[model samples]
Target: MSDPSAAGPTIDPMDTSAGNRFAPYSPENHSAPLWIVSILGLIYTIGVLSIRLFIKRRVFGWDDSLIVAGTLTGLVQAIVFFKALKSGLGQVPEHVPNLSTTASLAFTAQILLLIALYLAKCSGILLLRRLFVRDQQNTGRLCDVVLGFTVVCGIATVVMSSAGCPSTGSFTTHCSSTNTRWSVVTALDIATEVILLLLPAYLVWQLQMKTSYKLRVIAAFCFRILVIIFSIFHLIARIKYADTQPSPFNIVTTLVWHQTLLAWGLISATIPNLKAFLQSLSASWGGADWGYTVKAYGNGTFEMKSMGTQSRSHAMASTTGTENATDMDQKYETQIQTRQVGERSSLGSGGSQDMIIRKETVWTVVRS
Candidate 1:
């Protein structure tokens, strides 16, 4: 899990490979900007969450619970980061009288950030699971696997941030996050983001919908890419600063990206519900469903139904018959007799015979 590039012994403080990021400048504080953005981001989340709860027949669910948890954790972590900022967190550690306090606060904030992300990411996964858990292809089983992997990786990040990895000492006391620990942690973070993204794409692409509709649904899920982008920035920041000595200057970018990742992660989890809520308004006003409507069924199953000009046709044939109440019978008889008087004149020994034939016909026509 250790990154060879960030090995402490090889790091050159005088060198600018981190590209002027650690340049000596006026000691600045990012507490206010971060606080403002963090508050606004959470408010956005809350606004969407309110709509979600108020929407018709919306029941409190596990995903919603995770959203709430992530939001709360993020709020608390923001406060911790602000406190760290107040104590020379953005200044050179040597210049600060209380380096230990700043380091501890920052470390705690890192753990909390990872925790909030874990919760938010799980919320999004569960929301997606509602759509795929019952797929005929059974990719929901893959969703399950991803969920387990996410949980494992998320916990691993928490462990790595709280206590150093490679079987080292505690985070604040002896173990330093700069020793390739954070590079590994951030790599895992990016991996989770990538995997979460792939699941939605895979599930949506396999759907029985028009290509346009599939794209629309997948586009709706694309909000997560913002999180991934921010995570990539976060990873780069971690790696760039990993070998840099702990100072407010070198840590500011990392701090900003950390906040960015947390806020966006929480917000992305709420986007699906919020997007549907907006689309519902559009639909009420006679607007398009943008190609699909997601229907959540009982037993936590759901599907995205394509919307368009659809027609259904049915045909039926009916026949009636009646039984005849009356019955008729007809009979024909024929008889033949030989006359001896005429035959005796021809031949008395041979006897002549006369034959008679009769024909009768009976007809009936009935229609019902």
Candidate 2:
């Protein structure tokens, strides 16, 4: 039933070995390396999920898109990881079934998934623009342009990848005809990666954060830029060895490095958003319960140090104390009563006052 022409080379015809191939695709030769990488990926994914679930809120905003992107990418890596295990270590019969189709499809999906990861990188930065940019119109227009570019790159990658195959048959021998197109896609991919990495650095440099905060933000973005360097290495490897016989070891090594960077990129991009989400959540619950109070009397107006607004019109008036020593005792008592009442009202009504307020003179921090 077997076609003589369709069978690939024997692993060792003279020895008549049961499972080993004499000459095989590179990845099929070794299982240990792939398994190791797979385990590491699993461990990393677990850590990522934990942080995503349990982390407390911080000062920055979290982008859900980045979260989805990270989750999807981890899943994709896991799929490829299992495939690598099979291809590298699984037994091969004298006439093993050709997996060119399955393998090719898996690799294709991996590439596409990576591109999606990169696009998510770009999208995350665009979201940051919305948060940090004071100019509404500029942010909106920049988002439109960046989004359109992302779409074009994605379409190009999919089309070129599918078209690279010579035929639909999985068993076909020359399925690598589209290598040229892949090269083109890789170049475009690298360009977009560079642009995405640079944009964040530019934005961070221009932000009006404190010197210390600015440095911290810049360092975060810099780590992402280093991920792009890994991509550059991948691109170089791809170009250097694309036409050579499939070296599973070399390819897997390259893929592992690339995936590692991608994992870090997710973490890096999520940091700011994570900070924001926690801060917002903290402010929403029990944060407004805290307050600042100032007790004073006379012609002089009492200012609330904690209140950000220019006037205390929104603040309830405490017992009036003015120009009289005897009134001080009564006035202080009234102040305490009024303060307690306002705090109770605020809690009962569910209002948000800035969680941390700095006072400028006259205003006393009655409660913080």
Q: lDDT of all predictions, in order shown? A: 0.60, 0.48
Give candidate 1 regions above 4 Å deviation: 1-32, 92-97, 135-137, 165-179, 280-368
Please give, for residues 1-368, the per-residue lDDT of candidate 2 as tens digits: 98987887655533434555433333234334445655675577556545544442221223444556656766676676566445442223223344554355446545645664665566565555544443347655665676678668867866776665533232233346545765776676666666666665565555444555555545545555666676667666655546544434335555656566556655555554334344445543223211212211121224333443322322323433233443222211112212120111221223322122111123333322
Residue 175 displacement in candidate 2 (angstroms): 5.7
Mind giving the per-residue lDDT tens digits that candidate 1 earns over 106-138? 777778889999998888787677544442446
Candidate 2 segments whose C-alpha is farther than 4 A from its true place:
1-28, 56-62, 87-96, 166-182, 247-250, 273-368
Residue 197 in model 2: lDDT: 60
Compare the candidates by lDDT and give the number of the best one: 1
In candidate 1 the C-alpha lDDT for residue 76 amounts to 90
